[model samples]
Target: MVQENNNKGNQISRRSFLTTGATAAAGFMIVPRHVLGGKGYTAPSDRLRVAGIGVGGKGESDIAEFAKGPADIVVLCDVHDSRAANSVKRFPKAKYYKDYREMLDKEHKNIDAVSVSTPDHNHAVQAMAAMQLGKHVYVQKPLTHDIYEARKLTEAAKKYKVVTQMGNQGASGDGVRQLMEWYNAGLIGDVHTVYCWTNRPVWPQGIPWPTEKAEVPKDLDWNLWLGTAPQKDYVNKLVPFNWRGWWDYGTGALGDMGCHIVEPPFRVLGLGYPTSAEASVGSVYVDEFKQGYFPDSCPPSSHVIMNFQGKSGDIKLHWMDGGIQPARPEELGPNERMGDGGNGAIFIGTKGKMMCGTYGMYPSLLPSSRNKEVNVAKTIARVPEGHYVQWVNACIAGYGKKELSAPFEIAGPLTETILMGNLAIRSYDVRKPKASGNGFDYPGRYIKLLWDGPNMKITNFEDANQFVKRNYRDGFTLGA
Candidate 1:
């Protein structure tokens, strides 16, 4: 038989549980029902109770992976009911909520961990809220939209003593370990330059917003979906995937694929923050005769150059998106793929070069013969169960008990480095009216923006500082 709390007079509502001290002083223990055998005791369970914030698209896959591990999907929340339908069906016993705030307020005590897979803009606030309640969090790639948010989350993870992992699964793969081993063994002697390229933004970009407002889907909560962004009418095709091309919601190609493609070089080189950054974006042609720039949307393509100070020396990393790729190495055969064909990263060092594809797959030395001749002992341990299982186990083991590959301490700086490239991209669009009143003068072009990483600011270009931290809409904040 299970014990029950019969003290109705002392019972406190879930909303007031975290705030009220009376419940604690009155000798009322807020233990889960399963652990009611005694006070200050926890029932040993192999499962971790998890609540998913964005249960659709990548969120759906994230939850699915967690379910395969030691997690029990207890609650599902999404602004769009239709988008969350599959996850709800997969975990029918889980309660559902449209708003994350309501779910956290009522279910915080019940949930042991949270998986945040929402848009880039809302990630920080939602993850912060969960961390504030002492819940472990696994947020998707490009941890936060702004640099300041990344810094805050990194600090909070330590302050709150909660386990955290970013959803850049490549960090857990064996390929990266191989690269690290090769680097450590001096196969590629002191890397000085790197190139990471991606062919993303398959959706619409460099276009004007829809002129007409569309009716909000009956099953969708528009306000909740636009959590931190300014209120705007719902637009067709933006809900599920197309949001990546907009500055208001996504971090463009860099945010979408940077973590997967850049993680290898960042990890192998042991980089901190970028010291300077610059970029050149592809222009959009409105017609056969006229070219224009869209400040609200990400350009169709871009090439960002960021400099990082490494222990060996200064490292220069070039990021190319929208199908742009670096020149092929002359030592390779003509038929050999430059980096898994379309998306990959290359490291240029003093002695030789090495490259790999997205997710750190297919790492190889410059010449095909060198890869076969060189074999370095593995120095880094591989995550056998992969990234998702790694996080689930880490959360269960408690903070500081298990090592996470992409903890906020690591992922935060990686995300900040990736987003720093976007600052240069956005700054390239800063314009002022021309003196002759004919066109606009672009002041941000042809200038390298010096970065002060610790302070999260652009020292050379003051206009670029606006993007370091964004002003959140009312009712949403990076919680303290």
Candidate 2:
């Protein structure tokens, strides 16, 4: 299924300018707007070429989205051979490779865009490489593993002048659009607080420590799976999907779901950065917590709180999961059901309220009065039709914000918000003594997220703030 055709897009200077040698985040000395497409990068249309990394699970669906109309899936990439094969089967017209970096270099000018659906740890690395090549990027959500990376990805996309979209499809969906529209329209007067959660325990939660290394599957690439993370023997329990719960690969539950859960609030409120953040958990434990590594000071089942000093008011947005919810009202919709693993959110305003669960605020609005579900906002066309399509279309028709929603500017913060949960987990452990001992511990811990955009620090508490920017093993500093 390998393609042999040449690509068509011109090698326009990626965004405003950066010589392709700039390494750190803000190392270049120039006014950003002037140097980095002071306005925005011009996009290419007519004929678009695309590739996909991490071509398993959700990656499969992403392939189809990119292949719609005038777009060709040229290269398939993944850490595992099996995953890559699956992607190739879906797009029998594309070639396959295990290392995305190799594919980018070999394919060079052939790939115009790349879909990055790798593990949370690899998103930035893979996506950043694609951007450096002047290829547009579409990365899956929880866009970054940490706060700094979120900003780094944004800066890279602008530097490369590529069209980009975080995998948070809901950002442009019908329900979320209403969640914010209602707030903006004053339907939910003076929003004060928001609570959201996802019921995700299948990925090794509620289980004891993994003392034994899982027999690495031959089909799996153990080394690739652990990219950038400290080396360790492969464990089936943490491979593929379960990694999300672990401190190493996935971003824990919050990292897994927060970008979607907390997004409505971030957008509706026009939130800047968290003022402070604190997390509490129930019996947190890790095989081993390393400094500079994830789980630095957090438990596995950590509940993180990100507090933002809103322009109009102060609010505390709570996160929870694992057989828990924000307290369901006695009633639910007729077949308008909420999965037993209740994942959703509820907003508390000065008057009445509004709530949406699991798939980004769908069910019952609050007050029951105005809570009636109508296509209050624009309809969200499901996957092959909705989010993914929107991103591709927008990129093709330059200046398509409404089309390619969740661009870097918006996605950067969304990813930063979710990473708080991951970092918070890094700040707790089941056997270790309490961290930031302000009486905050697993089962009943609270760290408020304080946003300090100027400093790029969380300013919640010195102990917690230090965690926001973890020590990268070495040579992996946030490419500045």
Candidate number of the best lDDT: 1
lDDT of 2 by residue, 21-96 (tens): 4432336443343454545533232346788888888888887766765567888888787766767777787887
Cα deviation of 449 in candidate 2 (Å)? 6.1
Query: Candidate 1 lDDT (Cα, whole model)?
Result: 0.86
lDDT of 1 by residue, 43-90 (tens): 434467889999999999999999888678999999999899999999
Worst 10 residues of 2 by lDDT: 1-10
TM-scores across all candidates? 0.90, 0.78
**lDDT of every model, 2 decimals:** 0.86, 0.65
